[model samples]
Structure formats: structure tokens, C-alpha cells
Target: MASDTDIGSPERPTRPGRWRWLPGSRLGRLIIVLNLVGLTILISGALVLNELRRGLVNARIDSLTTQGELLATIIDQAATVGEPEPMMDGAYAAEILQLLSNPRSQRARLFDAEGRLIADSYWVSDRVEWRTLPPARTRGDGPGLDLNLSGGSEDDPDSADAAKAQAALRAEVNTALRGVHWAGLRVGVDGERVVSVSIPIQHVKAVLGVLTLEARDVDEIIAAERAALLPFILIAVAVSLMSSLLLNRLVAHPVRRLARAADRVRLARARAISVPDISRRDDELGDLSRSLEDMTHALSERIDAIERFAADVAHEIRNPLTSLRSAVETLGLVEEPAARDRLMAVLQNDVQRLDRLVTDISNASRLDAELSREAPTPVDLRRLISDVVSLYQATARLGEPAVTFTAPEGLETVMVSGQEGALGQVLRNLIDNARSFSAPDGVVRVALGRQKGQALIMVDDDGPGIPPENLENIFERFYTSRPKGTAFGGNSGLGLSIARQIILAHDGTVRAENRRRDTSTEGDAPEAAGDIAGARFTVILPEARR
Candidate 1:
């Protein structure tokens, strides 16, 4: 139930709330998370920028290669004719520059046989420095273009030049140079790729002079690519940072807080999980935190109960030891032989009582220890109860009480998993103990049935009921209703304790409390008011391995 005060208004708190995040701890996580995110963003951006630059460089190389080949073919036609020299006058260089300045061609250059740059479209001057380029070769053609001598080949030129180093290319070109056709060649710049083509001057298919074509518009290609990469890398870094922080808030922080809370709980600094909710958003972490908090609280209560029980057990055993030792000493000091015999008999009984107490203590302590070693095997619980009730049938009939076993309709072969001997002993103890306390001609009923996944065995007795205060402790080791020397009815105080241990070993539980007459019996309200009711022992065991 929630109180009116617990219900809240729509308004939010004005000042800072008693912090949801851990003080002095969240700062470190924040610093680490942000630093890691920043590093990732920076590295990713650099890699993306590098890839964009590489792609742009590759595209520019292809464009430059094609433009250079076309420029070489145009230059070769103008220079190859000996009768009229357009290239020799050098005035047509401006017209060549204008042609090469087209935006589609991304590079431009003119080279002589000595690998000297004769002109450049971007330089804008005929007096531009003739830059030296790395040695290159021009392809050759057939020997049909010479007009000077009868048997002279057009390849035997008069000029002795460095371009003669291209002898391999010359042999290939000689096959095609006898007729007008294209001659492919390359001239290496410092680092850039330059495509160029050659044409023959001496004959329709013989090499005499070379003309090369190139481009000068490479800057636009590089600039356009850089423009997209710059913004793309910047935006990617921003998104990575935001996503990392969001993930920490939604996922990492809650898990870390739960682990820290568990550590504090192990040290007993906190009774339950006291960490605040880091995630206010309705999501999976919210449900996990709630579930964990509930489990921690329940576990803490169970542990506290076990500790208190241990203290009670220790206190209960001390009184029995002191009584046993005092009785032995008193018997030794007696004088008369007849009196001595009587005292010895009394001492022997006390000794047996102490022995029973110690045995019960040892057995109860090891209940869980034994169960953890192995799982119980399946056995017929119906036969076990019948055997136990039959064993106690003579004692039960001493007072002429009615001892009846009522199992559910298909229970003759009902099976559950457990230690057969221990389980049978528990049933026998429950039945025998109930019989001893019942009124003459009263009914002691034993019932077995399957409910859900558990085997429920119940024993009901007609007798003076247990007091409410002692009901919970009756199954504890060494606990008994009768004081020592009450001969009317007192036991070794072991029957119920042993029964509980056996049940627990099977991973089950046994509880004893007064049975309400209205619920358990026909036409009887006496037990309902706590006066003439009987005690009921209910045992719950796992049916699959029960």
C-alpha cells in the first residue's frame, strides 16, 4: 500500500537531487569513457581521410595517362614535316598551350629528345625552365619513310641524342612507322604519372620527330575529393563520441554500480542493494536493477536467519552438558549400595539423553553437507509410509487410537527421489511421535499426494495442540516439550529433529503447526480457535528428484 505522501506531483526538483550517480566515482569513469571515445574518433577520422586521398590519387593517374597520350599524337604531326617546321619556329607554342589548357585534361608538358621540358601549359611563359625528366622511350615503326637515299632506312637519323637510349622501343616502332599510325611512349616526372604519344617525321611509317600531348587541370580533381572527406571525417568523430557516452549511460554504468553494491553488501556495509538508479529511461537496465535489488534483500534476510539459528543451537546444548556432568558427580558420592544402584540408573538415563542431543546436533549440521554430494534416486513413497505406520501400529493401538493411512487414488506406486532409508525413518518418526501424544480412540491420519511439482506428505494427530510460541522451534535439535524427569511422556527429543534433517537432505522442507479444525476436519470448530486442535506436520519434496 502506498501513502498519499509517497505519491508525487508533476513538478521536478529544483536543486540537485541526492545524486543518482556515485559521488567521486563517476568522475573517473566519465574521464576514461570520454578519453577512449576521443581517441577512437581521431583514429577513425584519419583512416577515412587517408582512404579518400588514395582513391582521388588513383582516379587522377588514369585521367592523366589518357590526356598525355592524346597530346603526344598532336605534337608529333606538327614537328615531323621537314619542309615546314611549326615546332622549329616556337611561335605556335602559344596555340599549343591554348589547346592543352582544356579543363578535361589534368596535366600538360612538352619534352625534347634530351628529356628537357620545352614548354608547360601552366607555366605561361616560353622562357620557362626546361626541367630534366627521368629517361623514357618512344615506340618505333617500319623503314619505309626515308626520302634521302635508295637503300637507307628512315631509322638511321643524323642526330646523336640521349633519346637513342630507347633502342628497345625503336625496334617495336619500326614495324608500324612505315605507315601513318600512333606510337605509345612514357616520360617519367619526379613522382607524377604523365601519359604521352609519338608520331614519325621521316616517313609515313618511320620515326623522325615526336609530338606529345598532356593536361594541366589536376588541382580541381584533388580539391573536390578533399572537400567531401573533410566534413565526413569531422562528422564521424562527433557521432562516435555521442554514441559512446549514450551507451555508457544506458548500459555500462548500471552494471558497474550493481557490482560495487554487491561488494559493499559482501562486507556488510549495506543491508540491501542501496545504489540509485543511473538509468531513469524506461528500458532493460531499469528492470535489471530492480530485480537485483529485490534478490539482494531476500538473500540478506535468509543469511541473518541462519546466523541467529546457530546462536540458538549453541545456547540449547550448553544446559544439557552441565546437567549431565552434575548428575554423574552426584552418583559417585553416594554411600549405600541400594541407593547407589538407583542413582546409577538415573545417571544412565541422563547420559542417554545427552548422547541423543549430541547426535541430533551433528546430524542437523550435516543436512546440507550430505545433500550437496549427490542427488537422490526415485523410490515408492507410498510403500515407505505404509511400512512406517505398520511398524508403529502396535504402539499406536496401545491407547486404542485409530491410525489410518489415506493416500490419493493412484498413490500406491507414487514415486519421488530421495534417500529411501532416511525418508522412511522421517515418516516413521512423524507417525510414532503423533501417536504417542494422541487421545484414546483418536485418529492419527497420514496422507500423501502430488501437487504441482512437489510431493506433499501430511500427518495429522488428535491431541493436545502445541503452544503457538514453541510451534516454530519444535523441529530444532534437542528441543522438547517435556522437562527432564517427566516420566509420563518424554523422548530423546530426536524424532522431529531427525525428521527435519532427513527432509532437508532431500532438498525439501518440513513444518509443524496447529491444524485448524474447520479446514482439516468435518463439523469441528474447536481446533480453529486454537483450543482442541491437533498438530500437523507437512513435508514438501521435489517430485522430479523428490
Candidate 2:
């Protein structure tokens, strides 16, 4: 059962559970959504970065390999030359030394066929400095494949202090002569990353001479790439951050505003709700806000309607009370048999009026309760409608004219779950109202079937058609429109109203409209007898299992 306080509250307004509220509401949802989006972008970026690093490293290795091969080809071709060009200065000599001193060569030797040094790129002042170069770590691939450069070409530093770095370069290249791959040496003045390549000369598998030159430019290339990586990464990260911030503002901000507006509307106590009167702009958020504002206005109108009904109910009941009291006073003065009977009749009519008022009040009060009530067992709606119309047709025939049924095919097994009595009462009331407005010999048409997820039961009469104004008010309690000088158009005026109440209690709906009248029979149609002169009442009930 719902609470009394809850009854006054709109059931559709409040819902249970987490309630979609946030710290600043929409802003928080925006932050969370953007953060998740940004995080996904960052993760994807990191994967791309790692792959880029691997590609850069592989590219560097390929460059280094090509450089080594070029140096080796140069050494092979140069080794065929005789003694050093006689006018060679020290600078030219150092260049030549680098060409012959490459460590990847198996040996960098300068020897005559008699086996004496002509000019070993790895030999400086005819003394070997073991400490200048690390020992070769692996054996040559095999005999002829080996270049076998001379080993440890530098003298000890104590003996060659002024040319220590040059000597050190010579020694490193000689040690690498076991099998030179690639090499670097900062040989000139403080070892500034200057380097060389060397290959030994051999004829008929015998040592002949050595050829040497500066080695591939590994140090310079490594230095350049390392410096460029940081700036490139920095620019990429900056762009990503700026883009994310712009997206948060452009996309998330408007959505947050709409969410806040919706929340405030829900929290409001007044029946009239407005959301700052937003316009229907082209943007998506603007459209959403404008729609919310429109919905609020419409909702307020419905609330106003319910409130007016509450007032109308009170006003309507007051008239009958006043009349019933007057009739009671008049009955106390009965002086003859005829006067007494007339006065008694007036009192009875007033009692019936009170009953009608009370019934309307009770029906209105129970709308919510009945809306929530569990349905009764399923009853085939065709059978229910047929039974009601058949019984009421007899009543109609006794009045102004005959009642006729207009059931179509496919209405046989259509069903619904509701109180059978309540449903039957709705149909009988419609038929009774139809008869009241109908002139003698006028026609009453009844229909029953299924449509749009509900069973449809309709009653139409060719009677004094409904006025456009009273079409809405006909179902109001104590709302009668009996033409003067007529004893017909009967009842305490709650027939249609009670009928609507019963249909609605079954999770259904009922509505009335003035049917189009026949021009040929216009003069013959009854006048001012019902909510409408040419009225039609439609009752809809939910479909149930047959």
C-alpha cells in the first residue's frame, strides 16, 4: 500500500536507487567521462611510442651495418697501394691511419713481402700499448674470411704521453683486428669521438700491407638522434593535452548544464516548472534543454488540471447539500395527501443527489489505489461486452428506442483482467446515457473488440449531440444537462463519470466525443439530453489471456 503523503505526491516524479546525482552533478559526469576517454588515448599513445622507439633503434642498427660494409669495401680497394704518399702531412697521415686502423678487420698490418712494417695504421712509434685497447672477444669467422689486423699498436703512456689518444686509437683498432665489426675513437686532443677503419693486405694468403681510414660516423649519428627524440616527444604530448582540454569544454560543458537544469526542475515544489526558458537552438545540447523546458510547462498544466478537479469536486457537492436541506424543511409542512407525496419525492431525489456526490468523491479518491491494484482473473472482453449490452438493450428498449450491438469479427476471444462488475457497470452506464439523449426511435450502437493493446468497447447513439464545451465536463460529478420540462436524461448526473472511473480502475481509459450527426435526421435527433447531443462514449480496457 502507498502512504497517504505519497498519494499527494506524483508517482512518476520520484524514483529510487543511486539517483544519478554527482558532486556538481553534470560537471562530475563530464569529468569522469572525459578522464576515461583521455586515459584510453594515453594508453594507445604509449603503445605507439614504444613501437616508434623500437623502429628508431632498428633503423639505427641498419645504418650502422651499411656504414661498416662501405668502410670494408674502401679498405679492400685501398690496400693495393705502395708506400705512403711522400708529401703527406700529419693531418693526412692521421686520416690514412684511421683508414687502416678499423677494429672490425682481422689484422691491420703494413709489411713488405720480407715481413717488415711499411706503415701499420695500428703501429705508433714502433711500440705496442696493451692497455690502450681491450682484447678481442671472439675468434675470426675462419681463415680467409679473417682480416687479422695487428694488435696493441700504442706504446705505454709513460713513453708516448704527447700522443696518448692517438696511440690509444691505434691500439683499439689493432685489438679489434681479430674481426673488425665497427669502431669509434675520440683520438684528437681529449678523445673527441674521432674514429677510423682499417683492413690488412694479403696476397696468396700471406700478409702484404695494411690500409686504414676514419671509421663509420656512429658517435655523431647517435648524438643527433638522442637530442631530437626529446623535442619530438614533448611536442606530441603538448598537442594531445591541448586537444583533450578543448574537447572537455566543447562537448562536456553543455551536457553538464542540462543535467543541472533537470535536477533543479525535479527538486522544485511548485506546480509550474521552467528551465530558464531555453530556446530550440541547432546544437544538440540546446535542443535537449529546450525540450526539457517544454516538458516542464506541459507537466505544470496537468498538475493544474488535477488541482481544479479537487476544487470542482468540492463545489459540486455543496449544491446538493443545500437542496437536500430545503427539501427536508418543506416536507415538515405537508398539509394534504398530494402535497405530502410531492414533498417526499423531492426529499428522495435529494438523497439520490447526495449518493451521486459521495460516489464521485469515492471514485476520484480511489483512482490511484485502483491504478495500483492487482487485477482480477482474466475474463474474455467480447463476452463481457456482449453480456452488458444485451442486458442494457432491454432497458434501452423500455425507454426511448431500441439498443443495437455492432460487434465486428475477431472480438470473440479478446480478454482482460478486471472486476467483471466494474467493467459491466461501465458498459451499462454508457448505454443508459446513450438512451437518455436519444429521441424515441433513435438508434444506439454498441461495439466491442481489440485495438492497440487494449479491448475496445464503444457505445454511440443518435441523440441530442454533445455541446463542444460540455464534452469535457460530461464525466464530471453532478454534471447534468437535462432539457427543461423533461423527466428523461435521467440519474443523479454521475453515470458517465462513474463509468470512466471504473474503466480507469482496470488500468484502462475512457473518453467521450460528439458523433457526427446525420443531416437528414438532424431535426429528429433528441436535443440537450446528454453531455453531448450527438455524443459517443469509448471505453478501453487492457487485453487479457483468453
Candidate 3:
């Protein structure tokens, strides 16, 4: 039994993780990745240095092993001369050790089978202790120490530590005396990396002595390897800088300019947006720029249309108002009963005219908004026209023109995509327009069919044909031209105009033309004397796809 509050409660939202500080802007994201290229270069350089260090140390060990094997071969010959006791010839061994000694950056040593130090290359050479001083003590002291410095202090604690480290070297030699070669890295008493290798001296399966080699300058080799990566680091930095510059110029700067142009339009400082530099580009940003321009232009046109419509409405309302005022003022002065009755009749007419005009204007104003609110569906034009015409026929008076709908022969339906209510209103207006001009006995005909993948509906009447010059003018708002007998202001001119608007909104076209009697042209029907018959209004709409 959980309460509604508990059940409906949402979980707390999690905050974004690291790297969320990156800006949401496109340019900011590009700049971040571009600059990270420099970091990538640093990481790759470090990896390359590490690999070089390993390779160089391994090569040093291999060289030491090779040199030791040659020296061990010579020492094995000298030590094997007294085999059962395994005694080294001191003079011969010393000569061999001296020839191989390298005291400046490397050391060579020889150990007997019993683990006793036989000879050391370091003792044979001149022992210059100042050159071998530890970096910590040397850097701490003054720089101008005597250049001829001979040796370290005999009682120095650091010197005693170095003697103890030399004893630890015996373990590596002893491992070789057990008949196995050894090679590895170790830190010396002076805190420098030493590449050590030891090989056993043997004569026909009898171990005699051990030959050992040490490369003391491994740190220098690693430093040189890092220095070699300098050029790559410089190239990466230059590439990153170039990328940032190009992105700012070609992408970020142009977008910012377009944003500023749109802001001007929003603030009404400019009538429309024109991001010329961005629009010239052939990309998505260019499409956005062009769309903004088109939207602003459309808004400007709509504003102009609204201003003109307001002026027309005022002009149309003023006519009826003036007439009503004249009729009202004259009613009090009319002496005869018939004159007073006529004056009252004029008042009623003007009042009715005002009502009709207001109603039509209201409908026209809301037409565009209402159409946009409703989603369009497939509308069957044949059925829609038939329904409207049937309603009219059902309510017809004795002298009113009869309404009829005709569809193509053998055609079941003609469909178009549009709002049903809107399309229905369009048909009703067209039919009513035709009826207004028709004679008492004339028929207002609605013919529906399809042609060239378009739905076509033609409203025809047996009324007087529209004058050719005024055919297009008839669709203009508040422009009415009725028959002589028809009462003034009986119909508002907005009907045809509203019909055209709704049709156009549905991506359809409407036009007016006169239907004429057939003329004889070699075996054709004979021409009627009057030539003109009645006006025909045709509408063409895109056909609905399956």
C-alpha cells in the first residue's frame, strides 16, 4: 500500500560527469579536441622514450655479454693450466684485465671460483674520486672546487655505504660462478642506474672464474632519447594552432555573425535577416541562413497584407454607415406615408448590409488561423461537392436556381488531401456565388473529375458571363458586380475571395472563365448567335497519394 506521492515521485537527476565543463557551443567543442592534439603528442613522446630506454639497455646488456664471453675465453685458458687445484696465473690474468679495463664510463672485474675478488679494473686505473662524486653532494657544494680533486674522504659515511654496495655485487658474480650468465639493471651506491652483466669462465665443464661488466651511463642514453622527440612535439603544437585558427575563421566566426544578424531582426532594428557570408556557403549552415531570410520576407508580406485589409474593411464599413445615417436623418422629415416607408426600407437594407459585411470580414480574418489549427486528411472531392449541392437543393425556393453535382462517368471518387471543413466551405462558397448570378430557371452545376494527376472541380451557371476584363477582379475582396435587377449589397464580395484563399492554402488553384456555345468548324456543331453562355469557375487540387 504505497501512497500516490511516494509512487509518483521521480528519482533525483544525476549531475553530469567530468568533461562536462566543455561548452555546448559547436566552436568550443572543436577547439577543445584540436588543442588536445598537443596532449596526445606529449603522451606519445613519453611512450617513445620509455621504449627507447628499454631497447638501449637491452642492447648494452647484449654487448657486455659478448665482451665478457671473449674475456672469459681468455681467462678460462689461463686458469685451466693448473686444473685440479684451479689456480689463476696472476701475471697473465692482470694483463688480460688491464687490456679490457674502461674506468671512465664502465668497469670490468674478475672473481675466482671460490667467490674471492681476483682483480678489479677500477683498482688498476687511476682512481679519480671527484669525477665519480654523487650528484646530490656535488650540486650542494660550491661550483669552483679544485679541478685536481683526488679522492673522497676516507671516513665519509657515503664512502662506507659504497663499500657495502660493492660487497652486494659479489652475489651477482656468485650466481655466475654457479654456471649461469646474468644481465640486469641495478642502482649503484651513487644512486645512478647500472647495466650489469656477468658470465662464468669455464674450461671443459670446469668453472674457473667470473667475468663481469657494468655500463654506468644508462641515464645519459635515456636523456638523449627524450631529446630526439623534440621535433615531433614542435610539429604537434604548430598543427594544433593552425587547426584552431582555421576553425575560428571558417566555422565559429561565421556562425557568430549569423547569430548577430538574426538578433538584429528579432529586435526590429532590421526588417529581415541577411547573413550573406553564411548563405554563400554550400552546407547546412547555408540552408539555415536562406531559411531565415525567407521566413522574414514572408512575415513582411503578411504585415503588408494585413495593413491593406484593414484599410479595405474601413472603406467597406463606411459606405453602409453613411447610407444608414442618411436614411435615419431623413425619416423624421418624410411627410407622405409611402416616402416614410421607403426611407425605413433603406434603413433596414443598410443595416442588413453592415451585418453581412461584418460577418464576411470576421470569417476572412480567422480563415488562415483556423485552417492551420486543424490537421488535414484525405478528402473525397466528389462526395464533398455532392453533399453541399444536396443541402442546397433541399432548401431551395420556388424561383431560386436549382443546384446539381455531376461527377465523371464511371468515376467512383476523386480525392484530395486537405482539411474537410475548409474544403467544404470552399465548395459552399463557389456554389452560392454561382446561384447568385443564375436566372430563376437556370441551374448551378458542380462537375467533379480528375485530369493530369490533379483533382478538378468546375462550378458552372447559366447566369450572365463575367466580362473578360473583370474576370480576375471578381476575386478581389469587396468588389461586387451584380445583375441590374439584383438588389444593391445583397451579397458580400468576400465569398469568392475567401473561396480562393482556402483553395490556395490547400496547395490548389482556382480561376474564373466564361463558358461559350460551341462554334461550327467544318463538321462541328453550329455556333449560337449570342456566342457567350455563362461563367465557369474551375478549381484544381493535387490528388491524394495512396
Candidate 4:
């Protein structure tokens, strides 16, 4: 039960809650998707690099553990003393740890069974840790005046950090003293990340001390891995930028142009839309451009037709009004009885003509809306024509022309796709037109047949044929040209025009042609040679598919 406006207007429903926050424009959405794609790639690279970092850490731990175990075995054999309960010779273990440690990459430390730090490889190798001193305070005399030159000041931040590392190292040594080997990541004495391994120094099933090895280059290795992931991030960013630009140029901008063109049409700034560049593209947008242009063109043409129809109606109505006014004025002046009677007749005729013109104008104006409102279905031309001809014959007077119908042999029905009421009106209009032109006692033939996949309906009359020049003009609104002795104003001239309009709306054609007879045989009359018999109105409608 939708109204005409509801049916004709395009839908613009509100967006659902979940999608309401999303960008409404195509370019905005494209940018979001492209950036997300790049971010996904960057995240995937980070995940892969994370796995690599774990593998490197585990490998470093395993390498340090192997070295620590070997050093612990050597220290147990070479630096152990005492009888059944073995004791670690601190001095001897320190000498052995110094000879075996590689101070450039690793630091070796030894803790006693009491979990006390003993031999330190950094002190034994005399490796100096270099650092840049901070700027001197304004209260000091020189740049190094307030610097904490003492390595283990209680108030120093480095001292507090080193204390935490020492406590963690003590825990690892205690665990090793229990005869368990440990290797994993931990904080070094210098407050830097390192991979450390602790192995027990045992002799003859007696726990002596713990030997620990730490690799302080673990942070450097992770930094290098992160640096290697930079190229993938750059590539993903570049691709996202390129995709956004391409989409804006190829899709977003063209769609914006189409919208602007439509706006021009809606605002009445332009009669029709014509975007040649967009229409040339071989895509859906191109199709849309072409369709818009066609629709606007059709609307413009319809406006022009309506304007012309209004002007024609005004002109036709004015003529009758002028005549009626003149007749009324003259009737008042006329004195003779015959003159008064003639004036009365003229007034009546003018009134009748005006009424007929108004009725025809009303019908013509509503023709478009009626045709559009009624949906088309299969219509049998044969039955429709027969019914119209029968009605004319049933109402015929003795002096009127006889109406006859004929169809092709073996043709049961001539079916077409059209509104039954509209098509029936078309038949009625054509028959009435033909009867109006026919002479009394003459025959008007209504023929229906199928030709070339079309249902053909021809109405032929045995009257004066239409002039060749006016054949097309006869279908124009308010055009009437009657022969001699015909009653003036009896025909409103809208029947043929309305009939043609109806047929055109049904995707059919109607035309007036002169029906000619050939007298080329050996006849006695040569003056009747090639004579024009009468006017034939032919209607061709596409046949309905079975």
C-alpha cells in the first residue's frame, strides 16, 4: 500500500548502531582498511622477531651452561682440598677462573658453599668498565668534584641496582650449592640484562662451591634483531600510502564528480548530467553515469511535452470561447426568427465543441498516469478487436457504415503484453476514427493478424484517404481535418492521438497509411488506375512469448 512518492523515491534508511560510527564516505573506509593492512603486516613481523629473540636467548643459555659445567668440573678437580667432606680452595679456584674466563664477552664468578661471593673474573682479569661522567653541579669547583668515584657508595643509584643483582646472584648460587644446575636470563651486577648459567663445583659426591658464567651481550643481540625488522615496517607503510592514493584517484574522486553532477540536476542548474570521462570507463560507475544522463534527458523531454500540451490546450480552448462569446452577443442583437434560430444553433454547437475539447483534454492529461499505474498482462488482440467491432455493429443505424472484423485463418488468438483496458481503448479509438471518416452504407474493415513476431491490427475505411503530408500530423493533439459534408466539431481530434499514445506506452507503434488499389489489369476503366482507396491505421505490438 505504498504511495507514489514512496514507491518512486530511493531508500535512505538509517544505519544500524554497530555501523553508525564507521566512516560513511568510500575514501575514509579505504584509508582505514589500507592502514589496518599495513599495521597487520608490521605486527606479524614483530611476532616473528619475538620468536627469534627467544631462540637466541635459549641458545645463548645452552652455550653458557655447557661452558659453566666444564669449568665447574675442572675447578672441582684442580681447586678442591680437605678429606671426605671436600672444601673449595678459594685462592686456587680464583687463579683457575682467571685463566679460563673470556672477559670481552663473558664474566665468570665463583661463590662458596655458604653462598658468599669469592673469585671474581672481572677483578682477576683487571678489566676496567669505562663510563662517561655526568656534568658537575654548580656548587662544585670542578667537573668531577661531586662525582661518586667510589664504586660502592650507599647513596649512589648504581649501588642500589648492583645490590639487587647481587641478591639475585646469591639465590642462583644457593640453588647450585644444592647440586642443581641453572641457566637463564637475569640482571648482571652492572644493572644490565644478561644470560647467566650456574653449575655446582662437586668432588667425589661432595658439594664444594658454585661456578657461574654470564653473557652480558644479550641486550645488544635483541637490539640488532629489532633493527633488522625495520625494512618490513617501512615496506608496509609505503604500500598502505600508495593504496590510499590510488583509491582516492580512481574511485573516490570519480564518485564525487558523479554526486556533484547529480546535485546540479537536482538544483535545476542543469537539465541533464553529462560526465563524458566517467561514462567512458568500463565499470559500474560508468554505467551509473550513463543511466543518470539518460534519466535526466527523459525528464527534460517530458517537461517539454507538457509545456507544449498546455500551450495547445490554451489555444484550442480560446477559439471556442471566442466563438461562443460572439454567438451570445449576436443572438441578443438578432431580431428575425430564422436569424435567432441560427444564432441559437451556433451557440449550442460552440458549447458542445467546448465541452468535447475539455473532456478530451482531461483524458489526454491523465493518459500518462493511467498507463503507468496499470500493470501490463497478456492481452488477446483478436478477441479485443472482435468485441469492439461487435459493439459498433450492434449500435449501428440503418444509414451508418457497417463494422466488420477479420483475422488470419488458423490463428486462434493474437496475444500481446499490455494492459487489457488500455489496449481495448486503443481498439475502440481506432474503430471510432475509421467509422467517423467512412461514408454511410460504406464498410469499415477491422483486421487482426500476426506478422514478424508482432500482433498487427489494421483498421481500414472505404473513405477518402489521408493526405500524404498530413499523415503524421493527424496524430498530434487537437488536429482535426474532416472531409466535405461531415458535421463540424463532431470529432475532438484526440482519439487518434490518444490511441497512438497508448500504443507507444505499451512499446508498440501506430501509423496512418493510404490503402491503394492496383488497376494494372486489362480493365475497361483507365481513370481508376492506381486509385487511393482509403486510409489504413496499422498498430504493431510485440507478441507475447509462449
Give the lDDT of residue 160 in candidate 2: 38
Model 4, runs deviating above 4 Å:
1-229, 235-239, 246-270, 274-287, 373-406, 409-415, 440-444, 522-530, 544-546
Ranking according to TM-score, highest score first: 3, 4, 1, 2
**Weakest ten-residue segment in model 2 by summed lDDT:** 142-151
Across 1-546, the per-residue lDDT of candidate 1 in tens digits comes to: 111122222342223333335222343345446656676777677656654565555555555546654655555555444554333323354366555654545334343333233554545634333444433435663333332211112123332332242343343234323434343333223222333333333333334333333332334454565676668766766676666566656566566666666656766778877656543547777777677778887788767866875776666666656766776787778888998887666667667766765666666666656655656778788888887777667554455667788887756667778778778878878977787677677888999888888889999998777887888788865567853335421365667977987887677899988875544455645545435478898999887632
Per-residue alpha-carbon lDDT of model 2 for 134-176, expressed as tens digits?
2344575333211132223333222334256545545644544
Worst 10 residues of 1 by lDDT: 147-156
TM-scores, each model vs. reference = 0.57, 0.52, 0.69, 0.65
Q: Is candidate 1 or candidate 4 better by lDDT?
A: 4
List the RMSD of every prediction in angstroms.
Answer: 12.3, 11.9, 9.7, 8.7
Ranking by lDDT: 4, 3, 1, 2
Local distance difference test, candidate 2: 0.57
Q: Please, what are the lDDT tens digits per residue for candidate 4 over residues 1-546?
A: 122211122444323333234443455455657677768877787867664588888898888888888898888889988886779999998888888847478878788887766777777666676655433456644333122111222113334665577667767878898999888888765677878998988887778888888888877776776678778767877777677676767776677677767766776889999999999999998898899889989999999999999999899989889988898888888899999998888888888888888898898899999998988899888888888788888898998889999987999988899899888888888888888888888899988888899988899998899987899999998899888888766778899999999999988999998877875567645534578899999999999999
lDDT against true structure, model 1: 0.59
- CA lDDT for candidate 3: 0.78
Name the runs in model 1 displaced over 4 angstroms.
1-54, 65-97, 110-119, 123-273, 276-307, 329-341, 369-447, 452-454, 460-479, 482-536, 541-546
Output the lDDT of residue 518, model 1: 45
List candidate 3 segments past 4 Å from native: 1-229, 275-278, 281-285, 374-376, 393-398, 413-415, 520-530
Can you give the lDDT of residue 434 in candidate 3? 88
